[model samples]
Target chain A: MKDGLVVLDKVSYGYSPERPVLARCSFQLDANERVGLVGTNGSGKTTVLKLIVGLLKPTSGHVRIFGQPCCNERDFREVRRRVGFLFQDSDDQLFCPTVAEDVAFGPLNMGKSREEVRRIVSRTLSLLGLGGFETRITYKLSGGEKRMVALAAVLAMLPEVLLLDEPTAGLDDAAAQHVVDVLAELPQAMVLATHDPRLLGGLVNRSLRLTAGRFTPESSRDWAANPAVRSARQQTA
Target chain B: MANVIENAATYDASFVPASVWRLDGVDPRTRLIAAVSFSVLVTAVDSLPTLVAALAVVVVGAGWTGALGQQRWKRLIPVNLLVLMLLGLLPLSGGATPVLSVGPIVVAREGLVQALWIGLKANAIVLGVLVLLARLEMASIGYALGRLGVPEKLTHLLLFTVRYLEVLQREYTRLWSAMKMRGFRPRVDGHTYRSFGYLVGMLLVRSVDRADRIVAAMKCRGFCGRFHPLDHAALTVRDAWFSALVLVVLAGLAALEWA
Candidate 1:
């Protein structure tokens, strides 16, 4: 019943109790808000995204998506219908044999009619500038093309919120720019977990830095000054 | 490095091109049924003449389907080598009719005939499979299998294997390259064996992690433990005709076996 599309309140999670990955982290993603989650490796950025999507549950606190408590698989089904999560690795996300089938996967799972799934697959591919790629083999695609197809597959579901994990992790400049451009045009609330601040430019309105299982408000300039970020930016540039 | 990854990701580069095969236009369900039925028939015929006839039929079908390309021929090399090994070994087995005696080794005529029969059967089945199913993409094959009453779980397993095999291959290649860069030469030594064991362990861990991520991605898209295929398999006139032709050929082969 809140305005936030996703709200994680005082959430704490760990694979084992002795080694907590996230501790009492709280965040709110409002409608149409694009929030960038930046963290060092193993800083629990992916964990937070998983918790929001209900793949992983909080140990102590609550995760609410679309103003509903996401506590179980049934509750998550409703959340997942409104939120799409892109895995950090494109290989993990795009598991279908062909690009068309992969894109149609989400819509078809929603029990859409065959004709509607076909239309959604085609439209989603074209939206990502991947027309004529229906029969393209998923494994044979180039790195950038695979990422684009993975994103297209996510977008095919027509989610209200997008949870993207490192959308530009290993992509080249052109591919990363393509992703940035495609994402910039989307109106959905987005929570992007990435280390590259440059990828967040003109897309995410605010940045949250995760450190020691905690979130803090951070400016893009502060992130740009980090040596690792500068090196990544230079490599992409 | 990127080029290596790209090459690793290329799925079954030796597969015959669909464009080369006119039969590629046929429904996958029809092709799969025909291939499976022909393979069964090839296995059933025991006589040399009938087996040879089956091989002839396969050769003709392969030619018609344009499966005689260089890439497909390259794939047959291993099978040909195995057949050669069988020919060399099987004929040396003890039997009633000795055909050739070389000092201590006696080659029997019956054994030789048996080897030839098995080889011919193998060749027929392989050729039939190549022409009928190899030209089709794995996704189509999975769909066809699903339509043909294969268990849903098995069909999905096939699809997942086809989809992720290349990804795991890439991961292995990257790990191997890293080892090579670190001066890890693979010789017949304990270090080399241990390193390989470690590599396998690492690859397994990476694959499991990737599977976890994939499950999360699936759940995020509202996956409910069931896959819904976008394309429905419907038998058309062409499929019916293809099925009839295959049945007629199989029947002719059966008649030849009896004759």
Candidate 2:
């Protein structure tokens, strides 16, 4: 545990005690590292990312971020400020009237000046090749455009770590490729929970396999570093 | 990518205010103020000449701005229905002189005048809002309300509803199409009602899920209780001119009502 940026130690969670989503799950995201999380549809891959950001409280486990225990909402406030979470559904993340407003929401909430938020919004939108989309209505945007705008909204906060859930799902090849290209250039550490194995070629440095509420034995450091594999399962979390 | 975004504007025509109004440049606060003043003045006018004059002014303004999308006159339908009902019922129930009647139903002249005044006043207010305020985007209205000393929470509710109305509408349509594909026809029966009820329940449940996710996303970016709107651009000369023009019309209506 070499000062992992995020560490989930023996975490267990369930919507109900009778059915468990994640049990004794342990993982870590190191600085400047990009780890791809793969699992079946309900294997709790999403739960892992949520646990990292304190979006969901574990039934029993220790969740640490920036080397501090995040057991309550107040502690997670700091964690959330440094962590960007991209939702699986773009619609869930975009609640503002316009592209610029949605992008500015986070920064403005974080107490950034209006002028500074505007600058960040423009920069983030352009970074995703969506420049000049400030005033565009969010609902009117096409699917691909909406995805990029959602990404811009998250990136506008300038988080040090990103937890992206199915970042490339449902996108056409070009659109997904565009996302892959932009994400590959980012300096932040990220845990990409995705089901697409080959969509983002050479972008993820390693992979982890989650199953039945826990990581597979093969997901240990030995095989996770290997570059070749069949379809990878990223969490919808 | 530039082409993709450039193409976004092809569908962007509907959201932005059209310049045909010759008042698109006016600030929304100005338009809102004008609408308030016009509606108030029209409501106070009891004289037939003043009410008719106000209605005329509103109808001409509506013509100048052009109507919204389609079904332009559909909004006035409910008002017309109510007016017709009043004209028929009010004249029969009261008033002084019997103008016309068949059998036991006698139409009274006083009741007719009262009904006519109510109809005119209603039409004038509705038409006035359509011309002066309805053309503005809903977001503009929320912002104007905030600027007009409306409570922050109320304006937030307005803006939030506006932001997600289309999205929720699409969700509703998706559910409806799924139902249609499954041979679900909206017949006037228990089965149809139950199915519709179930659809609404599912939509509400999904809305709760979406709302949860949206809040989580917001928190992920350091949101507390406060919300910040981006720009607070000052009202321009155009807004002033528009406000002045609206005040003049309102003043003229007052003179007619009293003089």
Candidate 3:
């Protein structure tokens, strides 16, 4: 197996064959790499993430995770087991009745023993400073707390590569800052699709831009000119 | 008072606190066993006296859990009234041994006894359902059902419904508010039905759009819809003992009746 984390070779995808959402995009990640995906609303940044996670298959290309083709169910499941994801809407990601159950979901899905699952869930909760909230109903949590719980659930899965979609949206200044700090401290390689400048600032060393329907390299300077980007940066830093 | 009982048995958003419930004291499985046993034993009693005793036990149990708050009683009254009315009308139908006669109305002894038994049985069943809900939360119920050989796809659907019901409700409220802002009102005539039809159509469209976005998001996160219950607290020795005790007590009562 190759040492690289992920490899997408000339991948092309679309909802319908006539309308290609993502066109022949290719990208790769190495161990401990931090990459930021930036694009407009209709751009195919989200599509790329879906393809990597095997949610959507590319029309004609290959997506490899940990050196293996992520096309079959067995391959995708193996990849999914080792990759934690933070979805755009916190509500969509969190579906459990209680905070603890939500956080323990991924670990449980991976079929860990009961004791180990409990320990990992508790540790992740406390690490996020949510120690006294095991039994709290998930719906009753504040937006920021819900985000933390969502991340904690994935962290419990203990993935090697983490993918986040707008992790800081709806969070207040303090909560967003806390999220930034938490993301920075993670040992895993990360690919963040975000509009939060604070989350993308000094933390991510590489930036991938998606325009119209293709992937291209971009710089921090290019990202600074956009009004939406400016607002997100101001909110964070 | 009526509202109190209703709130206890029904879904109340206010009852769900921000903090998680502790699973330390009693195993949910054991509580489930106890609840099922109690419900069956009480439901089997044909005598009014035994039925009343079962209802009392249920009430006491609810009280111990602090679930017998004002909300619980409020909910129970309407159902109680309905049961009363049904039983009251039963004596009027056919044969009657008139213990008391008032003009055209005859209150028969058998009818009175039968009504008491019916009320007792109804209360016992209601109490049992409430206790089961409180002890075995939705997640555990889903897990138990899944373990009992329910199909994964159906279980996922149930789980999705549970998760998204609140989201759908919030969306519906927002849609209603938007309609109200536009001076939309329900008329008593046929126009009201047409307007309602329009509203439902819009709701369906919105739901489909929301579902699409949700599916996209879930796919990005590697969701395949086969849910596995997380580190569930273990069923302890105490749990077994309690379950056995409940079963034994109910069996003894049943045996006595048989003898």
Candidate 4:
């Protein structure tokens, strides 16, 4: 019942009922809290985000976003509007033929009047410092540029909560720094799930580790104290 | 944005069915056989009624496969109208006794009927091909082609074409966006056409460059000329039986027509 941005209460999820990937996973995020979720491969980090977005439903327990139950179509829809999900693979998320079209997709799909959608798209592109990238073909974008375009597209949606899955997954030092800077500047509750530690430096005050398909909260200091995590986090920093 | 999310939440993934046709489940070889069989049967037959019947079979087949949903059917309705128009025009190809005459238009009943037949047959062919392509990945088709006497190199070309289309579409989209940002508007003027030609020439150059980069990447990953599927599809008992059933049904339909 608390006014948390995201609340997962003992939720268990798996693609198949017989085999559970996320076992009784639970967590909560308050407004403007930058939380990091770290996990090894297949540790259900990405699955957690999908569950919050209602891309996958829990087999048991519940997930509440903005204090409303998350699984219901209506609530999930509202949560989606309030939350921006940056899918790990920008290729799948960026569906429009052109950079401008891709950024405009979420707005257009929302079906605002033409002029309003145009304004929103233009504003988002300029905000991302990609003002004239409207006509640029999405496929022609370099890996770094594509990441920026993807970020710009999500920013255009203007969600209250941003769930970023490895925003710096495939980028050089400079590109990754740009993304980190953008994340730092954004003033919203964010749950960043990443394998990279540098993206976590100075941004997150709390850390949650995904081990054996469940989240365990640890202090930001302890997360940074871990030599391995520190080394990975420092790379992007 | 909240409103949009709410709308998307109401959306169900089930709206798009996972399977497209019988070929969807069958082994690549079997799917290829089915596609080849259907394509050859439809093309070889000169008789209008036979072709019409073949078209009906494909149409029904698509529906049965659960591929003929709202989107596919929506595309078909407009196409059906255009086909009707074509049918109307066939009889009026300056034939004698263009039966019905409207202002500035004459309808030749025979030509019109013939046109209808052609249109129906064409649609049938298109429908069958779509089902095949929808269910069977191009690699599977390439494998089938290789199995059925197609040279390794030609099969490779088809595979490249299929993959290239996706890449080209993405490239074209980016290029179009770039042009749009520069306030480029498409016009019917000569300058527009000239720019369009240049765009196409650029596309070819980009495709070649992309292909080289991809080849290099693949080489780095130790890729050979051949790609082995993660799941090697084979003819199960069910697939064999399904193929038999299809052959029997098609033969029965053909016999009924003969009778």
Candidate 5:
């Protein structure tokens, strides 16, 4: 965690005090590492990603991005500009009425000129196979198209690292495969949070299982085949 | 299903092309101002002949864009029916100039004229606003309003609400289907009312949750309460010409009313 690009040390968070979702989750993401935060439903996988970008402050421990501790909102502003966050719900992220505007939101927010942002938006959308889709209404697009546009919006910012929370969650088999292919070609180091073992195979270089409040290294590539992950770190290491 | 609706939309999006008065190149700001001023003029002018002429002008001007052609009965019928009801009640109010009578009932000519004026004015204002703004991209209204010194929060609200309305509608549809699948049926009973109340309550709760997520998403992209709409709509020669045309029409209508 010390040398990682994004590090969370002893992070814990929950909506209520009675039930803490994450007790002391420790995680790290290197510059080039495509890490998968694998977990079951309601295992605080999203919380870990949120903590990294300061969307949610950790209840007890420190959250670090770019080797700087983010204790407040102001510190996270710089962190957010450099880190791209892809939410599970593409609908929530694609708030602009048109595809081009939504994609331009991030770059423009960082004070890029309209001309530069226009170029960025077109280039990013074309990269995501959404060429000539600038004027297309965000809501009118199909679910798969919406997801790609959302990815385009994130990628348009040209962030160094991506915190992708279930990028292929609602997508169909073909759409999910398309997303995986798109994500694989991206140069940004991403920490993808998902329960899908199939998604982790070619996309992620390392996998960390989030269960009960903490992260533990997972080695068995076929974890889906053997659901009973015997905490086989000793066997692999 | 979507394709069917889209086909219908495509079919209905075109109307009789009086393309000579097309204001497609006009800036939304000019359109907004013109629409507002035209609405004010319609509402203020009470002269029957003037109102009739204004309605004619409005129809011809707004009709060029073909927005007036879409869902003709669906949009106009409701408003016209409501106006008809008002007209029906207007003649019963008793007036000085009676034009017709059956037994003891008297239909006042002045009341009928007033009703016609009301209908014309209402239709003119609404149709004028619709054709002026609705022809452009719906999202541009927010940015146009923003540029016209509208508060940023309102612009953001308009943009986000317009953006998410479809999502919420889809969610509502899914919930309705779920409820129907569960054997829920509307009846004239307490159970029906309670179920509806629960449905609305659930929608509200989910909307709040979604709003929170949307805000978080916005923050992740460095949205610092400053809504910088990525629009480059400058007031061009077309806007100036359109603005001049709007002024001339309104002035002519005003002179017609006063005379």
Candidate 6:
């Protein structure tokens, strides 16, 4: 088994038999590598991320993180400590009442001291250009603001690998650019699953498309040049 | 569309004002103690004069705490409706002295007084809670409860419910709007009923799914069956003095009730 930061060895997962969301998928995310997973809706892009983070167990194949097999909560601790997974839905990620509390949640859960957590929370928010938003109510924030805050919460953990699932799914151009700029500055390995190839333009070095429950290597231009995808991006833009 | 959800999901923070009042600066634990103690005393009183006096005190407290604003007054409309219903119904049950007699219906003065006393008690207690709690944030309430030895599980439930209520409301609104876009005009029909039922079921399923996702997110952040608060406000002398004043006021109200 090749040691990588995150490795999925022929992982296959299904909510029920006779149907699998991810079928014998295998990939490796090494340190400082930027990988983009692109697929149509229901192509199981998110399942792959969940499998990497130990949120879902593979039915047939093994998954490894940092050369250790991730099977349960105990094993996931190491994975979670080193990898930050940004949920596709900002609402699901930012559950705390206040922005500051949500951003501090990861650090606090990591058992960081109060002062250290506060400093990291402030620094992370400012890095995401969300300074002075500490006391702002979470639900009151705009979608763009929520996305940034959610990212801040994940980044506050200072993970070595980022598993982002559609980080710019519902964001505007400005917000999307903001996220791109921030991710550009970060030095962590990232696996970004997004419909927007524009987001992967300068960020991801390699792209894979999940088709018929299996991942296949594909050029980013193939997805970006599709007429339907281009039209959808223009409509949202 | 994102903006619409953002507007719908916005928290109604108007319950607590932006500008700080003296009461706002008071410790949340102290305010919680005061509200609970005064509410108990107000509920215990049955006399019209005492309840009326308590109501007056509540109004004054609300005014002092900056809670006697148009928004806060709007929240009391349903309470007023309940009180009106009590006033209208209580008089129908006859008493010794009749205040109004009309075709086979007599409103007794005793019954009217009894209803008024109960209404006054309810108003006073409700106002007490509004004035005391309107200055504190929801997080502070959970913190104060946890500090006061409330079970961690209960406090966590309260905090999560309060935090997610707006999110759920937004989800419902979005679903309803989607239905409306599809020409779903609700009326008294089987289709409408079925549609509404499906909406509810969808909401429940989405809520459960979201809950699972949230739990997964928490665990991903290393949450291991414990909620560690990032900020903890220590009890200060102001809290002590405010609690002392509340105790004195409760004692006085008790004395007035008996005397």
| Most TM-score-accurate candidate | 6
Better of 1 and 2 by DockQ: 1
Q: Tell me the interface RMSD of every candidate, in Å.
A: 1.0, 1.2, 2.8, 15.0, 0.9, 1.0
User: What are the candidates' individual DockQ scores?
Assistant: 0.80, 0.74, 0.37, 0.02, 0.76, 0.76
Per-prediction backbone clash count: 0, 5, 19, 15, 0, 0
Which 10 successive residues of model 5 chain B have the least lDDT summed? Answer: B4-13
User: Candidate 6 local accuracy as lDDT?
Assistant: 0.83
TM-score of chain B of 2: 0.86
Per-model TM-score versus the true fold: 0.91, 0.90, 0.77, 0.48, 0.89, 0.92
- TM-score computed on alpha carbons, candidate 4: 0.48
Cα miss at A200, model 2 (Å)? 5.7
Ranking by DockQ: 1, 5, 6, 2, 3, 4
Which lDDT tens digits does candidate 3 get at residues B186-230?
778887688777777887787787777766545444456655676
lDDT of 5 at A63: 87
lDDT (10s digit) by residue, model 5, range B105-148: 88898888778777877788778877787666556777888889
Docking class of 6: medium
Native contacts present in each candidate (fraction):
0.98, 0.96, 0.48, 0.00, 0.92, 0.85
Q: Select the stronger candidate by lDDT from 1 and 3.
A: 1
lDDT of 6 by residue, A1-237 (tens): 459888898989987888788888898988889999988998898999998888888898998888988888789887897899999988888888799899989999888999999999989988888889999989778998888898899999999899999988888877887787788789999999997766665568889889988889978677667775575467546
Candidates' RMSD to native: 3.8, 5.8, 5.2, 21.3, 5.3, 3.9
In order, the Cα lDDT scores of the candidates are 0.83, 0.80, 0.73, 0.70, 0.81, 0.83
What is the per-residue lDDT of model 2 for residues B36-145, given as tens digits with 9 covering 90 to 100? Answer: 88888877777778888888888888777775444456668878899999988888886679999889888899999888889888888988887777666677788899
Candidate 2 lDDT over residue span A1-237, tens digit each = 466999999999998999999988898889988888887888888889888888899999899898998899999998888899998889888888788999999999888898888889988988888998998878778878888898888888899999999998989866876787778789999998886645333567777788888875333344434353222223211
How many residue pairs in model 1 have overlapping backbones? 0
- Model 6 achieves a DockQ score of 0.76
| Candidate 1 TM-score versus the reference | 0.91
lDDT (10s digit) by residue, model 6, range B1-259: 3444444234245644456565756878888888888888888886666777788888888878777564666557668899899899999998999988999999999889887777777778888888888656687898789999999999998888777877788788899899999999989999999998999899889999999999999888888888778778787887788888888777777777897
Residue-wise lDDT of candidate 4 within B143-243, one digit each (tens)? Answer: 67877788878986875555456556667768768987988888989988887787778888987867664443232222335543222346698778768
lDDT of 1 by residue, A62-154 (tens): 988777777888988888887888887888888888888889989988999999999998888888889999988898899999998988988
